[model samples]
Target chain A: MTSNSPVGQDFWDELRRTTQARIGLGRTGTALPTRRVLELAGAHAAARDAVHIPLDVERLAAQVREIGIGEPVLATSRASSRDEYLRRPDLGRQPAPGTDIPESGADIGLVLADGLSPTALDRHGAALLAELVSWLRDRYTLAPPIIATQARVGLGDHLGAAARVRTLLVIIGERPGLSVSDSLGIYLTHLPRPGRTDADRNCISNIHPPDGLGYARAAQVAAGLVEGARALGRSGVDLKDRSRTEALGPPSGSEPGIQPGHSPRRR
Target chain B: MIHRQQVSGVTYAFDGLVEVMAKATPLRSGDQLAGCAAESDGERAAAGWVLADLPLEVFLNEEIVPYDTDEVTRLIIDGHDRSAFSAISHLTVGGLRDWLMEMAAHDHGAEHLAAVAPGLTPEMVAAVSKIMRNQDLIAVSAAVQVTTAFRTTIGTHGTLATRLQPNHPTDDPRGIAAAVLDGLLLGCGDAVIGINPATDSPQATADLLHLLDAIRTRYDIPAQSCVLSHITTTLGLVEAGAPVDLVFQSIAGTEGANAAFGVNLQLLREGNEAVRSLGRGTVGDNVMYLETGQGSALSSGTHLGVGGAPVDQQTLETRAYAVARDLRPLLVNTVVGFIGPEYLYDGKQIIRAGLEDHFCGKLLGLPMGVDVCYTNHAEADQNDMDSLLTLLAAARVPFVIAVPGADDVMLGYQSLSFHDVLTTRRTLGLRPAPEFDAWLRRVGIVDDAGRLTPFDPTTSPLRSLASAVAP
Candidate 1:
């Protein structure tokens, strides 16, 4: 059998060990080695599972209660079923009827929803919220985490407007990938409402560890973002994540004029 | 900066102001044949591979960059170390072209250049890919639509197909059905008579599907139709029992990009299964149709970091592979030039990307096709698509989309025209999917020898009705 890993196979292996990219998974007898192929197949399954597996919302709610941080107001999006959430994205953004909320306004409306990767919330949702709650508990009036099922970043708008908060801090699971599945994202919007577009928010992505920001650091950045959005009068392209050195993709502040967050228009 | 404005009234000198509007011009479209020599069956067959074998990869170069570039050559001799590309990190497009041409001469032009460039920028490799003519790697994978007695495979040897895009200004069925008849008269609709509905409403999309389904049943046309709207809308249409032969989705390399299109792998599978479960694939199991290109990962911000190398195009290609590998699509199109010159500069770039994407998609074992198209605002013309389409045909590319009169009024771009399909069939001895071919023959559009004869549309049933539906 002929090896397709190039002549200096060891050198590529050395580089491979340093990063998670699919660089040096050497080929065996024309195709990828069976072991590596299986490994990839496993990774694909894990990523898909991260997306398809329903979140233990009860477990997540219990953890939030145990932490004694923020309170809880549970709700679902217009997408009642998992199938609808996956396809009708617009429904995921609109607030469903009968969401229990506080009539009085709060300083900050904390919303935790399942983004594309439910596993992200399963792993990091409780911890990130606890830290965020710990930091902002003294300075501002914090509402409980308004748990939403099948939610998008814009879902926080409806909750925030209903809660009558000056700002909405949404910590949701970001879309999963082949290498890193389960990374969470935080979107902060100033005066979020039902009709507010993505242009009204700012995103700090990759908010989990190993390849993402740590929970504490992510919380620290979220706090700073809340402060900045208040000072700047708006979010979205106006707000930026400058509390620390960036880790993945473009940092928040660099985008100009365009809606630098997730695409607002549905395809 | 010199501003060439013929203003004799006053001499205005401005420093650092070019007065040029900053626009990331959109990508161009179309694959057509404005001029070509007529040919007989034997003559056309002799010119190119008329009976080309399936899944052929003639241009498989094991050594991607075999030229005497100091960086790669050093790596070959220095026992392979890091920083091999440090000395040659950035080069002009011309400089990159020279190196690539030298490698192409050595029969080793398969280098994945994004593997070693700086993370933020990898345009040189992108430019090189756009320019390199991957003539060696020709491939063909075909899909068939079965009828009562026989079946015909699309992209088989001696065949090409086109999707008739009948779009309406108001998402109204009247105007759209007219255009469908107009295209069918020109020997189009072999690929699939699809529509790009003007609105995004699920009801409208589904209604268009039902209208087309009724038309197909009424005419007894042995062809497939698609409403190239979002898959959710298509799924709704399918559940409503509309005759949806193909469910369409615009796919990107990364999962995030796909989320924008309301698509995930699971949903894609569900849509495919839904269509299959309904027995809608009676003609073929080729159910799902996908559209992809470079830079979707970067644009969607889901592109993984390749250490420090540029990851946009490479990651995007792999992402397409991931989707294709999972779904086993009936048709996959890498709309190369649709993204504009900012991503792909000109004809050379568009042509090169079309081949690379086709090669990569086929390598991932999907039935790959090319939407040889460009946007009106892009820096391209029909001449560009003409060259690209001809090369793809010569390479025996499996399938391409077709529009009427080189213009898709609905999509607002030009694509492979009915003229291009006729040219491909006449000049390369390529035929349409067999069932569609038989339908065309029965309509007396083509003779028994499979040659398209001059058809008097006034005498025909549907083409004449097109005049009523059309302006």
Candidate 2:
């Protein structure tokens, strides 16, 4: 970042250390400096490439099996191709008709899908699944993990229904940003079924490693949400993530009861 | 009435008004997804030709979204100013286009356009936009100006404002403060200092609102602050005495789509009344901040038009302006390209949608701004955004959203940066909102002539802001 006054450089430096925001970039008559412009271009190139990259489902399944969570079951969303997946979101939320998924009726279901950023799912999916399953298996019966291709967040609903699990946790790659292209996200839904709106799910996003949410913290948050969902008999807007406030425990002293659905708001 | 046209010995007939409108819309991925887009360019041209010949009064008679099913439609039909419409009462859709172009070219065109703004329906506005070229949209939009005020006046000629979006992934107060300080040094945030919280919890929203209020009051900056949360969250916060300058909601065109958003006309009305009753304004009481986008209705599975036919996304987007106009919002912007590539596939489609939204909103009498942005998955880059930003600036859009470096870490999208805004303003000889410009000079962020001074963060008056949030 260029500073017009060299004296202010140190203060800006101190401030820049606090946030991920690009704060101190020096301007050249309303244009960004040469390096900053090129930096953004380079970042955008990576992110744009990440969106089109396909996840290697066989490799990801092998990686998940190595983690010893459960036998990885291969699956595909109704969207046959990436182009179709991007255009028709409705198709991405459902499993392809007649696809076989053995129903174990386990207490928890896990699905690893290649969302917008398959590269992210390919890179971090196994590690995150391993971390999250460690916190989940001892307390609940785990079903076979489903590896979904060309999926959206809602794909978990169909896969979870097929598994007949009480709760579904979808660990997927989030849409890439210029700053962080490989960030992963976890979505939790209780009693997963079709027709459940975003209100019926709670999201834990931006979980890449080192710089983003570390694996331990992300697993902790997911376990907390799973526990909260089981206690409340539901998820979505009614369930709050108190993982940051306290350790996962009983629902006593926590507001875990059915409440009316709250509307979704975003920028 | 049957809508048909002949193209090279081919008879193209549409099922109804909605079908005609949909087929005539500039090609976009959203309409194609909905199975309503024209099958060929010849069909689209034929449909446009038919749409142009339809009388302006057809909008008054035909409903795109059924009136009984959608309150937004009811608002347009009920609130239409017939007296104001009398000026253009006899014009066809094509006639209205020619008239607008002629008036825009005249010295006194702005007055004529403003005079009839109240009479125009969103359908009429959307229809004319479908027939107009990008340059026509720009020229007509530039001729019309709609202004609003809270602490600063916006939409005055020779001025462009920005909504400083200081978002953080975890809502860390110190991180937010740093970004806000950066924007202030660049003379941004003249439209409003708004935040899109990661979570919609009322408590978190209230805390951010409080943080912004504290900064706004401490520096006595001539601007308003908003925490964009659900209307219910904002309403509860208002009841609990939170510092709310603007009540925000992402409204849609149809009642079902809005209901999916967990909002309705009544809820918005209540929120508007609740925020206004707080008496938090120095310049005016325009407290509502409304946002709309093209594909929200279709995304929600609620974009039905006449005979259950799918309405074009752009028409649905314009109908949202009817909702915004009724609320008397201080700011109404379409988060144009934020919905991803499914709706607006590429740079050409995104730019066209941005201009169309701004044009329709201005013609319908709203202080419209555009979030000139794109998601990474969308086939767009910084160059696309630069093109859109320059075009919108040329159209004299009331405001644009500006992040620190065009990368919104929290929202995970790209938008115009502070430097981008400065570049547009300097290149176009525009200033910030009047009060914000005065405050900038008073605080030494800009010179006496309202030009940005070399920012010296160490001696800057805004150093107090850093210290306040400093650990």
Candidate 3:
């Protein structure tokens, strides 16, 4: 961002190109430059607001239908409000009567929840859901998407169990950092049910426009995991993302896992 | 009889709670440790006699007048002298007109008694501690600091130490490494040098651990490091063999608060087991770190419905006892000022709340410390922290956090600084934990007189790279 300046700013431009991280920003005597401060303040505001603002589940459901992902059945978690959800994560992780998660018979449960950042869903939920439909709509029967408000990763488990879906694909908004408030995340669980621990699911984080896991890549990853989970009869640490790994290039010969050795993302 | 047990010149509580206590686990390791279970059994038998014989007033409400209270009082009337506590406990709260007049002559005795009484409430501790001399305050309290395989307590088992929490703006190892370097150069890290990395992913946590591991190993510093994030994250890291000395989590005083955090006793048990399996504990079998503050409970609306619900912050904090009573922690920090003046308005209020949390946590039989801090928006300054820090030290708090430059860039708050630690140690004639102190001396950071020498960061292995990467 600083590279567009005229005062010999080539170094900062180089750094910016190499990493989206806020490095090489010139400072003003013991403090950050004013523009950087303003940008950060704006970003922080977005993150905080994202946590508090309630997502319009009806509008989200309509958007999903418009995108032809299928008509989503709007639902609410046990947490009725943003404050309650923030206070009680377990409530958000449960499927009570309010969520309207229909009981019985579906090959897969699809949940689109306004998680830690509702803004993330507003930005990328429809796109990702549409992408998932393009890939797996014919292969598996997706129960009407349950538009969840105030939800957590575990909410997917509850939704799937409520619908008796064999597998689940839940898209959620991850907790926003000082920057990057709209990062989307996907959690896939096989044999989805309540009381399914974190180890019973797989996580693919940081899906957003530009500078993140692209929807295509995220779909590829999710599809691979789902296929693996159905074959192995489970998800999470037990199942590897080896399918995606092989697709990415030369086989790493390891299970699907986080690659901490090299991948860099702005926290 | 006013029965009691004393070990290593420290008096142990063998009263009401002990009656229900399964067995005592040695909280810290160092000098002579008389088996807690043996004494606990003895106390349990004595309590059994009293429970069966003593007619007690039982309330359906939370408050119950323990038979031990009357038994202890009866012994005092019968001329028991093992503790001035017998004399102090039976006192009416009629202020100067009541017990203070008669107890003035037993000032020294009461102060000592109060320090070692494990079950004394914060208000009671404050009252007794208020009457003692500053010099007496230090002497009576446990001055012994406990250390884990990688971490150390600042003072004695009951006294205070700072848990240096150097959080990075991001979970960037580079940023955290710089901040930690700053704190270390100033002779902080008396409490375990831990970081609160912003990144929630387990891989990033592993990176932070591996980075600190390399730094500490290269310097041979006597400190353990942890990314003071969620216990689940730390649990995963521990399972992965990342260098974790303490598993950290935020717990509240009520079941609702714990639920809000998605935590329950079962999860804590699992986490404790995860840390225990490491077997890297240096301080006896104790190996847990829990954090609790007030707003969390109130925000959950748990405080509104119950008849005796925690209406105030102090009462709200005590609810944490319900959670802590199950999982025994090696270190617990009552992050007082971090709540800001709204909950605890101004310096005086902050000081009182800090003491109350410390007192309450200690009364519940956990090794406790106070995190002396304040947010930027709070109507507090360094002067307030200085006063609170000194009082906490005088109270012999288990630990306090010594941040780099006293400011946490990531958390956006000001807390105790590395300079503060040095100043507190030098002025109070206090030192870091024994092993940590030895490490400090061995590294020539402090002299034989326990005075800090001039620190030259240029000499550090990280200096060259840090300077190269300096923003």
Best by TM-score: 2
**Which ranges in model 2 have alpha carbons more than 4 Å from their true place?**
A1-6, A68-71, A102-108, A132-143, A163-167, A189-193, A220-267, B277-279
lDDT (tens digit, per residue) of candidate 2 on A80-199: 988888878778888998878889899999999898889999889999999988998899989989999899988888889878999998988778888878978888899999877788
What lDDT does candidate 3 reach at residue A146? Answer: 80
Winning model by lDDT: 2
Clashes of each: 15, 1, 20
TM-score of chain A of each: 0.87, 0.86, 0.84
Question: Highest DockQ, which number?
Answer: 2
Q: How far is candidate 3 from the true structure (C-alpha RMSD, Å)?
A: 13.0
How do the residues B207-234 of candidate 3 rate in per-residue lDDT, one tens digit apiece? 7778777777777776766677688888
Give lDDT tens digits, candidate 1, residues A145-208. 6888899887888888888999898888876544567878888899888878766778776777
What's model 2's lDDT at B31? 98
Ranking by TM-score: 2, 3, 1
| lDDT for predicted candidate 2 compared with the true structure | 0.88
Using lDDT as the measure, name the better of candidate 1 and candidate 2.
Answer: 2
Docking class of 2: acceptable
Q: What is the DockQ of the complex in model 2?
A: 0.44
lDDT winner between 1 and 3, please give it.
1
